[model samples]
Target: MADYRLHTIFYILTSLLSLAVLHWTVHKVLLSISRSKFKKANNCQPIPKYPNKDPIFGYDYWHALNKAAESRTLLSWLREQYRLYGNTYYARLQTANVISTCDPENLKAMHSTKFKDFAIDSRRKFAFLPLLGAHSVLLANGAAWEHKRAMLKPSFSRSQYTNLPLFERHVGHLIEAVRVENTKKGQVDLAEFFLCLTVDITSELMYGTSIELLTNGNKDLVRDMTQSAEGGHARWLLVFLANIIGNSTFSKSVSKVRNFMKRFVDEAISYRQHSESRSISAKPTARNFEGQQGTEPLDVKGRVIYLQQLSLGTRDRKAILDELTTILFAGRDTTAALLTNLFFVLAHRSDIYDKLRAEISVLDGERPTFEQLKGFNYLQSCLNEALRLYPVIPINTRMAVVDTTLPVGGGPKGQSPIFVSAGTNIAFHVTALHRRKDLWGEDAEDFLPERWEKIQGQGAWMYQPFGGGPRNCPGQHLSLAEAAYTVLRIVQEFSMITGRDSEPWTELIALTCTNANGAKVTLTEA
Candidate 1:
């Protein structure tokens, strides 16, 4: 209803604006008729000419009233810009509401040094806070964000990750599930399987319990919640409408899911606290095999897992769930999207796929074994290129807290900083930047994993799928490593068929990148 109201209001406004345009246009045309003999051929470029304006809409996403659409996609437009303007040009679709940049220095400053110069938009915060609840690090910033990050950092630390038996078991079950699906249907939904694998892994690692997502694949609860997140984000108009409606039944349902997760987290925290305070000082704990290279969970059965008593320190139940959700969501969705795309790319280009398979074969004994993934330069490069071509998050937005100036160059001499006023929403069109013609050359749109082979020492700003600086995704390195390992294993276990020549379309759901239909493919045993 609220969405309908907003649409009605927008339609009315657009109608009025159109009428006004018609009125002015009639007068202008009359004036032009009178001045045709006097006016020069190219005196003015166009009326309402916005100097230094950005492409408001090329990848037209009318699907979203106020937000960008997923289908038209931002990356495609970025390439179009290079075709016309060398590297930069002003594009206007709507009024002056959004400012976009593929400028490297602009990105570095915004994503890194001057990050706090902007804030997450209040509208977005209101929507997510209800969905994620409070104290979640994802919604937290400043000191709060720091504390939460520090607390969760240890879990992914080198020592804690020594639980390789756990890793092996999770991967084994994942492969097993795929095997079963393959037997049944001659194909498998890789995205769903990846989510299950990540969810199950997060359950064991974080809570020391099996959500049993992998074993039974019956737990549709998490799946449902994820769909909510995805579906909710798909329509910005609805989200805005919900916010406008405030306490409607739909709003309450959103709150109900948030509360449900809250309850689960609360119970876990309480149980953990009770266990810790018990101090059973039980039988002598097993030896500490943590420092050993490539140590799996089987090596430390009775080890004193001091932190087993998961007491919430200073932080509350809500924070834990937030971190838990953030990691789980981040781990599962991004990896699946990247891997799915990798398969599509490889299926088209056999040479690249074969080269990567050989690379993975050599890593038969070296897949993220403690630290091998970080050192797997070829695999790392391939993953980087994939991310560059198609970032999991095509675009990330920031709201300027104050009036700011963005540097512009290679234009008319004496052109200075482009001024953006406070409250102006700035979108870092990452997908556009990724395949930018000036920075990446002509083959920017093409998938060339070799593009990242020598990017480390060069102007790294051109390659920013994970973004750059402090707010740069902390999970990036981990995500990349996990992706390389998983894709390597998938290729090793199964050869993929990209459904003949029928291309899969991508749609942005919420902020996540998902297959418009499904990443459908036929797989045969490797």
Candidate 2:
């Protein structure tokens, strides 16, 4: 009787399993048919697809991951896809159906004009939450984004321009560090030095404290941050999987970095509290911050440190930490990349360096004042050319919240606009867009600051190294000013900057474009 019951149970289980398999197969077939009919009814041409090695098992994604791993970048693969598929192409990754484009009209629509139709894709935000914080301005959308922007925008005002002296101090430290290297070995890994300089400057200016990373640098922390950024680029599905699997090494490292950042913020907050208490006790009438110039309005100088502004509004430490990390995220590498690239190109070209040095010579060996930095048109042009050639964030992404049509780059002929369904993600390669022969001329690849000489009348949309529209980077002016000041300082100290290697700058992606082998330069003392 027991044997007979066991046989019957086995048969029942097999029958149910077969039925489940049949149901799934039929559903897939019906869904495929429905999609085809829907496309036909719309009378729209499908977006071009880049052929992949495997279509069924997400082998294309795997292939991309492997290639990215081998090349230490995903940019080469993206450029290849663009070459094969023209202006726009469609590919299915593990996370979403990606529509990649280099069409300027399409870019304008996605980023500026129809920005409301798309978002940063909340699904992808999860990957960065552990690192950038949940309410980070970099990831927040809608009212949340606006609030974060409001909190930090005032801190960048003209009165805060008094921080130029602070920027100069760090630049001075950077020059000293490099000068020592020039005396001893005649070469410095400027990539590393630039990272340290930016870290110190960002900490001091924003938190009213300095980490001294440039003076006493942290190699391990820098390596970990770079690794975190690279991991930040991983597909969302993989991140989800890692989260579900639980206790991942990546998760641990992320936590470690978060803790490290939190500690930095806590210390800054502690210092601010102590400083304020001392100021109140010492001077009952007024508690003055040293950098606050008497002529500068309180609206600007009073809120120079972002943390102080936030503390006035809320006692939420997590929010403060989030904003602090956000500032560090924005301020550190982006400026460093700009400065490093500027020096990299300047090191290779003597004429440009000579002109820049002459520009600085007029300052009479003193630090260029805030207004003085703005007048260096050649310096401004060099910075612009470097940004155009190697945009720190080369690619930007958005996802449609509803079915939408791009203004251009579609159809079998590749000239018509494409209809992207809801949830479809779109990306624009700023690197490719900046280098468009049609937009920037045939010599777009050349690093010529003079190209910008007659182009003062151009629109802001044409060159968006700092991004665009309402969601555009708020720190653009500050970055330009800081970089221009640093270049002037460097020029004042070094007459000639020479590349350690004659071979061209080997570009690499580390959440930003940087020298792959490192930007090594020898300083010729002024």
Candidate 3:
């Protein structure tokens, strides 16, 4: 009886102790967050307060204009902030958190040159952590990033993987997928079609498997990524917590995702291992990465040319899988969204469609070879126009790595030269920059493909649909080439007609920009 009584008392004491520890942890976390907010606010110059800002769009710094996409369309209430406070304005987003920054020069300084100090929102452990996993090349920070960049360089090189055969095959796959889906449809969702095409092409070339996502029409990876992004526990609330908690969650998720990638990589690695086991001791490398080796790196069509200094054969299984995941998420949705917008735009103007078709017909009465694809100047311009009008990744974020100054439109010292403190949050708001009236010209709001011809006069950094600077998308050519090819094939097969009178809006939840109603279009056989 005495022993039982003692044990019960001990149990009660242990429970109380645990509770105390938790309470202290939470209290300390709240204190740190509060302190950070206060420090940031004190350091910042005050701006007029706007009530009920949309949190979904960079922590409520902006207001939704009725049907404006939370992230993608129109002047974000950010313009209003810029208007009020000259460019560098401070807003108390959370109880103690202040988010600020909007200047082109500041954007350049934070993103490039000094990017090492400002880290990616490592808080993504909960929401976007599983996205690429630890093995994802794009997600890596240190040596891992360097390694992956080296390994994957050959795959997208101009002399190697960017050849006629691969391009045509993938393009064929895209066109064929569209034809199957749009057979005599009263109205086809071109967005869905393009999504499937990108996934199919990306999976086959990158993973050596079809994933059959098109035929089956559902994949866990795509669905999971979108779901986590839209609503995830870890990313949802980090303001009132310690940086350690957020960092741990993010790192843990990356680790978990890397674990997930292991399965796919293991399969590929095992295959490679077995294949090598059967091969002759000495060989001149496999043709799998054909036409890329020992060839002089040539600048093709004025794009940046660099030596293929990294051989991708040395990657571990986890690394390959992560890169594949990143590419799948990045490549598939982006290309799909681009094409969706293009078809949506092309459907209305038969004049534009007529011009595009006339150009396609001149592709020597055959599918465009990669060289011919490059030569289709009008098509490229039209696609570039689409990208400019609606970038796939509407916004990009970074941290202030150092105390810097941003030269915004107009503020103190003639321009809004923002004094950035290290650790301050930066919302690049590419959507705003792309639509900035001052930069894009008088008819910037209009969807005119001829904007490219005149864009030569505009600044290069100003027109960053595919982004600019050193960290710009390595796969820009791949994306443009794929999109151009799909668009070319789409125009070759059918014409899209406006199928609805209902107004269209872009849906921006998390990172991706997708059409709200599936990019509906009436398809007619060519």
Question: What number of clashing residue pairs does each candidate have, in the order they appear?
Answer: 3, 0, 5
Give the TM-scores of the predictions, in the order they appear.
0.73, 0.82, 0.72
Off by over 4 Å in 1: 1-97, 160-164, 235-239, 242-264, 275-311, 314-316, 363-372, 409-415, 457-459, 495-501
| Candidates 1 and 3 compared by lDDT, better number | 1
Residue lDDT tens for model 3, 1-526: 9999999999999999999999999998997786567545534333333454543334443224323433344335555555565544555444322344445565665556556755555444334545565655555564556545544554565643355555466566655665665665556677776777777666655555555555666655455544544433334344334344545434454455446546656665664565456642222322212233322122233221211111124335544565656766676778778887777777667778888888888764477677888788789889888877777776565555555444443234434334455666555666666676777778877888877765673356666667555456767787788788777776787744554426554545444565656667666776
Taken over the whole model, the C-alpha lDDT of each candidate is: 0.58, 0.73, 0.58
Could you tell which candidate, 1 or 2, scores higher by lDDT?
Answer: 2
Model 1, 25-110: lDDT tens digits are 99989866754433232121111212332345423322232343544443565445434453334444333355556667678778
On TM-score, the stronger of 1 and 2 is: 2
Task: Order the candidate numbers by lDDT, best to worst.
Answer: 2, 1, 3
Q: In candidate 2, which residue pairs get closer than 3 Å at backbone N, Cα or C atoms, i.e. clash?
A: none
Best by lDDT: 2
* RMSD (CA, Å), each prediction: 11.8, 6.4, 9.0
Pairs of residues clashing in candidate 3: 54-60, 125-250, 151-312, 411-415, 411-416
Q: Alpha carbon lDDT of residue 525, candidate 2?
A: 85
Model 2 lDDT per residue over 24-56, tens place = 999989977876676566555767886755655
Q: Pick the candidate with the highest TM-score.
A: 2
